[model samples]
Target chain A: MPYISTKTNIVITKEKETTIKEKLGKAIELIPGKSEHWLMLSFEDNASMYFQGKSDSGIAFVEVKLFGSASSSAYDKLTAAITDILKEELELAPDKVYVKYEEVSNWGYNGNNF
Target chain B: MPYISTKTNIVITKEKETTIKEKLGKAIELIPGKSEHWLMLSFEDNASMYFQGKSDSGIAFVEVKLFGSASSSAYDKLTAAITDILKEELELAPDKVYVKYEEVSNWGYNGNNF
Candidate 1:
């Protein structure tokens, strides 16, 4: 399973949220074995966030967590794609967006470890 | 640096939010080199979440991200502390809460990697 959560300073409208979700669904496919079927998503819009000690401009922090590992090249492509999606949908500059990936060794669900 | 983000299905009031933050501030100290000073926290209450394909009761997902590694025993302590905090503040059962940890090798801030 893979989970992608986005926190952004800019407000996300329902339409924008849907578009971003769709784009991210496609972006996650860059990984070899991950797909949107098992991808969980979350978005926090108009979040109280600061970058470089400033919050006057739009910024986005996206966290991608997967159950297993992926290649560096795969991560590189996914990052580029995520940045482009934020830039296109939220008007956030490429530099203002930060995407971090975590390969989770242990995940829990349904009151038990997975 | 360490960041703790919590997502739950229950609505978090202002008072509850403050209380949880304070409790988590103390909880982070369970890790040897970590403290509240460098802790950045985010809470997503009333989020659309599901467990075992159901959403009838309260559920929480907590994510802890650190710049470096920590021992498993340290994680165990933090998990218990976090679970207690959620249980006391949000009234969520321990079994319904999932805490995941990520140790990042590359972290970015202020337009550069750390």
Candidate 2:
């Protein structure tokens, strides 16, 4: 694996989970990894990207979570394409948005495994 | 869980995952959730944040991955603190960096669980 993993989180107005899922699913599909590596995508709502305890101005930050697949060098092209899709689909400004990644191992889930 | 989830991805110049980890570890501590929740943290080497097939100008995006315990609300304050830490610790401009979170479920790591 290239071991090139990164993630960012943003807070968007509430909409269909499918909308977010579809957009992210497209990006995840583009990530550089075998189909079985751990690729995570998580979510948070009514949130804000705080800089010094406040919302990030002008731009938006997003966070995604996942549980499977890992990458050394996947998702670079996917993020770039995602920027475009967010702009075209959500009508958000490309310059005002970005992404990040966080991977985990041997962890728990919602009061379980940790 | 509050069902509030989001994520973004970016690329950065090659550096120690520990540096990124320290900045993020602080943020993870700040998330408003019960301890031992599923909060993922994965790393990648030599990456770049893309916006429509190019680098994001003057700003940074981050993606965070996970394996266990889902969160509906937590980690908000943590990302903000991380933003400050990145600026102070790394001397990075606050306006140029942000974070995203992705949570995963029923997943595997490396060539295992999918």
Estimated TM-score for each candidate: 0.62, 0.34
* C-alpha lDDT of residue B36 in model 2: 21
CAPRI-style docking class of model 1 based on DockQ: incorrect
lDDT of 2 by residue, A1-114 (tens): 112222233444547445755566546666544222333444443333322222334333443333444453453454465566556555545544444434545556557764
lDDT of 1 by residue, A1-114 (tens): 678888888899977877887888778899998887666677778889999999999999999888779999999999999999998888899999999998897554433445
Question: Which ranges of candidate 2 are over 4 A from the true structure?
Answer: A1-17, A32-46, A50-58, A64-73, A107-114, B1-114
lDDT of each: 0.83, 0.44
- Give the residue spans of candidate 1 off by over 4 A: B1-5, B9-43, B48-60, B64-99, B103-114
DockQ score for candidate 1: 0.16
Models, CA RMSD each:
5.9, 17.1
Q: Give model 2's share of reference contacts.
A: 0.00
